[model samples]
Target: MKPLLRVVLVIDALLLLAFGLLFLLTPWTSLYNALQLAQVEPALVGQGFGIALLGLAWLALHASIDGAMTRAVARTVGHVNWLTGVLMLVWLIALRSPSLSAFGQLVGAVVAVVLVLIGLGGVRLAAAVRRREKAQAAGAGATGREQKQAEKAEKQAAQAREAEVYQTEPVTKVSPPVSPATGRRVEPDFTAAHQPGVVTAETRTVETRSTQTHTAADEARDAAADSPGAPRPPFHG
Candidate 1:
């Protein structure tokens, strides 16, 4: 509850308590002066008023103690106060008697109107408090939902990143080529032997003839050197 409203409720409770005590203790003088009654018993009227005031005091005190818990009670108290004020005004207008003076009736009417206005103020304050609490609860619920959604989104994004990292391809290492004859790194050669449809029968025949000619020339030279009756060649230093 608001501070100003709380203070007003406390003051109202105190006023009701004081008035109840007054009517209960000094029944004769107070009731006679306030109600202007001659025939009716003052004590009986005082007792009724005292009990009603005490009940109102208790309701007001309960509202002051925990406004949230006793909002309905506070509203009930407000309605009762308004009804009491309206009844008093109605009685003053409908039943005018010699016992009560015009000035006194006017004063009563004014006080009744004041009470009605105060009761309406209290009712309005309670309604406003209830609305504020409802709005705050709704806002808190929305905030919690938003927070949960944000956390879920962050979790999903983290999982996606992990999946992306896991799906990456690995690199393959390659070694340098080595020569077979020299046992060292060398450039590869692509020749007719390695190629398809290049080494034909005509090419093989030409290579065979070249090899036979070289071997025949070497044999002729050896036979000539071994012969005996050949022309003698002059020797020079």
Candidate 2:
């Protein structure tokens, strides 16, 4: 928890404690007089016991909020505020009786207002605490989700990097050179095919082309010699 939130909680708790003490000590004359519609000391005395019970209940309520009470105590305390609110309303209604003096009615009204204000403040504080708790829980949940997504993304990126490394590395493959004369690719081992005075594939292609050219030239010379009307051609020409 944040320090500021802790401080606010502590302050609210202290305020509740003080209010409880005030409710306990304050006299019940207001309620008693309001009930009788007149100032009656005997009735006041009797009602004091009931008012004391209300105060005890108030104390127990705060103790429950502080986690200082057992589960049963907490459950009972849950009703304390409602009960007190009801009691205050009843006391005020009783004051409406014509028998009550103006002074008694006025006092009763004041007590009712004060009790209501205190209870309301407490209720507001409890709601604030609950709101804060919910907001923190939501924020924590969102952060966890973001962290999980980032981890998944990182894992995918690592796998991709490993895949790239695997593709670029060298692997064994068969290689063949092209034969110019046949226009075919061959993978022959020249060293193993050794023969006395034999030529390599590259040399053989060149020699064969030269021999064909020389044969064509000889054929042309023979045609020229067989032409009877042709004068003897100069050697240079």
Candidate 3:
């Protein structure tokens, strides 16, 4: 409730409580003379009515203190105030007692107006509270949806990063090189081949084998010429 409205409700409740106490404590004769009533029976009836008003005042005071002047509390207070105001107006019009002085009628009219105004205020407070609650609920729902979307995007991004990391990693396993001379698997000499003016062990072994083959061929040719089945070569000179 607004500060001004709260203040108004507090003041109204206090005033009602004071009037109820006065009617309850004072004698019937005193009340009759104050209101200038012809009947003492009506003063007795006023005491009972005053007690009911005191209860209502207590309810209003409690609602204000607890900050619950909305919804059920507000509606109940509004209905009660409206009923009281309407009844007072009806009594003034229908009864119009000849014993009631001008001052008494004026006081009743003022009280009725106050009750009506308070009733309207209660209704307005309830409506304002309902609208505020609805707006808050809508904002909360929107925030929840945005949070879920953000989490989903984060998960997708993490999965993509993992896939990228897997693709970029180097392969570790490779087949060993085979030696041509022995036809066996051996460790490769990669650095020796890349260096300038350097001969590798595998290349030197291949060169030695080629020179031995040439020597063997020359010896076989000389032996064939010495044999009886060998053919003679034509003279070039």
lDDT per residue (tens digit) for residues 24-106 in model 2: 43355575344544443455454565466555555554554554332333233334544565576676576455445667667
At residue 74, give the lDDT of candidate 3: 62
Superior candidate under lDDT, 2 versus 3 = 3
The residue pairs found clashing in candidate 1 are: none
lDDT digits (tens) for residues 1-237 of candidate 3: 445445655755786797677667545676667666444355677688689779877876776667655355665777677677878877876777544678878887788888888877776776777787789999999999999999999999999999999999997999997877799998766596746799888779889999999999999989999999888888899
TM-score of 1: 0.60
- The per-prediction tally of clashing pairs is 0, 2, 0
Lowest lDDT sum, 10 consecutive residues, model 1, at 32-41
- TM-score of every candidate relative to the true structure: 0.60, 0.44, 0.63
lDDT of each structure?
0.73, 0.58, 0.74
* Top TM-score hit: 3
Candidate 3, residue 164: lDDT: 98
Ranked by TM-score from best down, the candidates are 3, 1, 2
lDDT of 3 at 84: 78
User: Once model 2 is optimally superposed onto the true structure by TM-score, how far is the C-alpha of residue 123 displaced, in angstroms?
Assistant: 1.7
